[model samples]
Target: MAERPRTLYDKIWDDHLVHEQEDGACLIYIDRHLVHEVTSPQAFEGLRVSGRKVRSPERTLAVVDHNVPTTDRSKPIEDPESKAQVEQLAINAAEFGVEYYNEHDARQGVVHIVGPEQGFTLPGSTIVCGDSHTSTHGAFGALAHGIGTSEVEHVLATQTLIQKKAANMLVRVDGRLAEGATAKDIILAIIGEIGTAGGTGHVIEYAGEAIRDLSIEGRMTVCNMSIEGGARAGLVAPDEKTYAYLRGRPKAPQGEMFDAACRYWDSLRSDEGAHYDRIITLDAASLPPTLTWGTSPEDVAPITGAVPTPDSVANPAKRAAIARALDYMGLKGGEKLTDIAIDRVFIGSCTNGRIEDLRAAAAMIAGKKVSERVNAMVVPGSGLVKAQAEAEGLDKIFLAAGFEWREPGCSMCLAMNPDRLAPGERCASTSNRNFEGRQGYKGRTHLVSPAMAAAAAIAGHFVDVRSWR
Candidate 1:
């Protein structure tokens, strides 16, 4: 008999597994629990009603992001409901004695962005948040996912979650990405190929040359969108690049501890010949700058492609979905994507609001002015990212090009605050989703890369950046 080979997910799961139950479920310890305003209020209320204290308050971190206005943070929040939610989170954090980052805190930002920036997200850790995009932390080889409010309360009281293991999925992207293609393009292409439900009930491990070659920020962008592809979570194996990014971070381990942690992280990869329930391979070089033409993220095509005709699809369900999406997006079959004009351009979100993303957009629109008819804005992912961008003069480049440089806080990504699309308005956005009414009621969205969005802002239409350049 021989020991069975294991995947990166298996290794991390085993390390954190506290107990196995007869019902085929296991109790896994959570190393980090990141909370935000939108999801934590109810959970805290549950704790108050039950007379329970957080089991490991020190392990949990709280921030106000969702529903917080991205503009003029210094003033009172305008929306009453939004203000209440933000205020309640601050009160709850104070009551629980948990670490909190409010709008005024220098460390304040989206939980996903703040976690990695603060080094609270480390390799081989089990992280949970009330956010679906908590999978973003998986970029460091961690096992992370979103949980419901009840599950949030459970984790808060017990510091562990009971769950069944997800099936293993390997997504390999070999070959170098094309010059104009980015990690956003690569993930969008993967979703487009597999459809939104392709990785359902699975934990996806993104590997191969293309993934390995991406910068840590790029890897984060890919893993951040795994949920959109219907994966339980997504991860990249920790390596030198992961270590370099973690080194010298505020909460990261110190010298000798970091070295030891690296040793463990080195063993976090899948063993050679390990079995996966399913596998997908992509040729990275063949991918173009992808954009969603319909409602779903999978309803995407290259910038040079056109809207797909539902009539051309053979499957009734898929055809119906395509038709419905096309109706919602106000698109007709066979219309060239480049010919579709946009009313606005938004280049910020958890998906693409980091400094690298800002730089990428700035480089594309450096000397080009935005179309007068198009309202374009650039929002950074976090206050830190904002300060960094300003230091590098990226803000000036964007302002000079007619793009409004605004504050950070998931702006226009969900339209929770004032940043939203007017009814019937169409936008080229860097956000992950393109669901109907995602940006606003009856608003149409076309998801694209930061550079593609910037290019669209300038051209006032969807043009292939490869050609625009």
Candidate 2:
């Protein structure tokens, strides 16, 4: 008799199963748990009510990010909502004995960014954060996901997650991406091709030459949106790049432990004959710095593509989505994507908030100042990235080019940080999500690669950077 073959997703999940509940769900161990201000308060309070302690406080890490102002994080936050969330996180971390990385910790950023920087995420582990982009940790070859507030509460009480096994979906992007086509572009293009709802009930594993060549941050950018692709999680096989990225991080293994861990990580790659339930391939040469002309990331088109005419949409459900996206974006169908002017330029987020992203934007903006009509800013993902960029003079290049060189944090990514668009202003953003009012009241967002955002900052419109490059 032949035994059922196990896909990589199943292998990882089965390795972590702590117990199976009566309802047919398995409670799996979470090797690393990352927490942010907005979601942890209620969960910690739930523990207080139940008189339960964190199942493993050492495995948990906390940060004050979503609710803190990025521009002036050194001072007390003014918004009562923001202050309460940030302060409550301080209290909760203290009560529960979880290590808290506060606003000026030099390690703070988006919780997703901080987790990897802290080396808490490792290969072959299962990680969970209360935030959706927890999938970002999958870049390190982990089975990770964002859970609900209640699930966060449950994990804190039990150190395990009740989850259903997901099918495996292999997404292989082959060949070399041309110079200006970045990780952000590759992801936006994939979402545009697969639609926003394509990978439901599945776990995605990225492969192929282009994906293999991406830096840790670039890999993180793609994996960060596996959820946006409707996948439960995403994984990239551990390789030299993954090992190199984790080499000297705070919590990563050291000396003998590091070498031994590498041996285990070496075994985490998909087998030569590994099986996946579904597979999709993309040509890297086909990508360019892209943008979402409408609403969802799936509403994206290469900067060269026109705003889709609703009547021309092929899918009935997608046609309605196209129409709604156009309406919310204040654009008419069949409009030229290039003619959609931009009022602001944002170049940072967990999605595109690393030194390489800043370097790409700087490379495009050097000797070219931002258009007078466009207000632009660059926010680094962490104090570390900010410092590294400054040492390379990228900050001066941006400031001299007329863009504001802001502090380190998730500025303007979600309007939770001090940076934001003025009412009714339109922006070309490197951040994820193009939801109406995502940046502020009535502010419109068009997600783009950092290089594209830089080109738009100078052109003051959504112009394709492949041409500019």
Candidate 3:
């Protein structure tokens, strides 16, 4: 009898397995450990208490992002708590001998953005971080996920983590995407189809022609939001696009080593007839630029659609959830999204703050000015991204269009620093989450594509970018 074929997740998991314990947990080697200011303080403290040094400091990389201010970064961080967190991360990294990127470093940015840009995240590697968006690295065919402070300590102390194998899930998107549709829309549509908890207990492998056609940056955008759908991690099988993006990256292998690495990465895909615990397919051509009308990412609809009525839902629990979300968002049932006005617009985050995203928004709003009623801002994901955007005059485009072009940081994405929405303010945001008070206390968030957010900034209301185009 022949053995069954294995999935990409299974292959990667097996390759990294250090030891399988009787409790069904395995010790897996970590190839990369990305750290951010907000979550590593406790783990560093743990190492201090136990009198243990980092087992492999070379494998760990730290950056100050979450707690850094996007405004006047040269000035002292105004928020005392945030300043303390950033300072602590620097102290910890120095004491641990781990490479640290401070706010002043040109490479410094969001941990997820900096990792890929610097080639620290590689294909067929096992990566872990204390941040939930660590799944963003899986776009390069790596197995990565967010862990707690305890797990962070374990990885730091031993360069390994104990974990149970996650069930496999395949999310295949077929056909070509529509003109105005983007990777953001595709993922939003999937979340809408499956709901917020759809991928719980699973690692999603995105496959099919549509996914294969997306640019490496676009693929990252899709994988970055997998956590929003409750997936432990998300992955994409790497190909030429992935190799092209990694080829000259700062940490990528050179010459013969690069060729050898590619050969191995090429083989890191699901075998024919591999079994998945679940499979879902979506038609890409039918998907429109989508937006989240309620508090959850799963509460999505086409840009032209209206807010859903709670009474329309059949599930009692879900109906109540919709009701609560509607009340919190200050939305009325059957309200057309286009009729809703926005007080502000935010275009940045790990999900869509890459150079490609900046270019898209810049092209959309080049000649048009932001609505007089709207306060719009653009924050790059990293210092590298910021420099590249300026080189292309994207910052000038944004500023000319009345959009404030700010420094790089995870600005207004989770409101960790001074950038945040006021209470009762509604925004058209290009970030991932839209949970209640995510942008600020009582701030309502409408998740959108970069182009859509740009259009909203100009129109002061939600409008279909396809029509604008």
Candidate number achieving the greatest lDDT relative to the actual structure: 3
In order, what is each prediction's RMSD in angstroms? Answer: 0.9, 1.6, 0.9
Q: Give per-residue CA lDDT, model 3, range 259-377, as digits (tens).
A: 99999999998999999999999999999999999999999999888999999989999899989999999987899999999999999999999999999899899889999999999
List lDDT for all candidates, in order.
0.92, 0.87, 0.94
- lDDT value for model 2: 0.87
How many Å off is the CA of 14 in candidate 2?
1.8
The true-versus-predicted C-alpha distance at residue 208 of model 1, in Å, is 0.3
Clashes of 2: 0
lDDT of 1 by residue, 307-331 (tens): 9999988999999998998888888
TM-score of each: 0.99, 0.96, 0.99
Colliding residue pairs in candidate 1: none
Instruction: Give residue 43's lDDT in candidate 1 (0 to 100).
Output: 96
TM-score of 2: 0.96
Name the weakest run of 10 consecutive residues (lDDT summed) in model 1: 65-74
**Candidate 2 has which clashing residue pairs, if any?**
none
C-alpha lDDT (0 to 100) for residue 94 of candidate 3 = 98
For residues 1-469, what per-residue lDDT tens digits would candidate 2 score against the true structure? Answer: 9656666677788789988878778879888889888888899999999899998999999987777776665688888988999899999999999999888787877788888887899998899999888999999999999999999999888888889778889999999998678888888888888878888988999999999999999999999988888988989988999989899898998888999999988878676667888899999997876888876778787777788888996899978987887777788888888998889999988898888999999998899989988999998888788888999999999999999887666678787756787787899999888887788877899998888899999988888777785
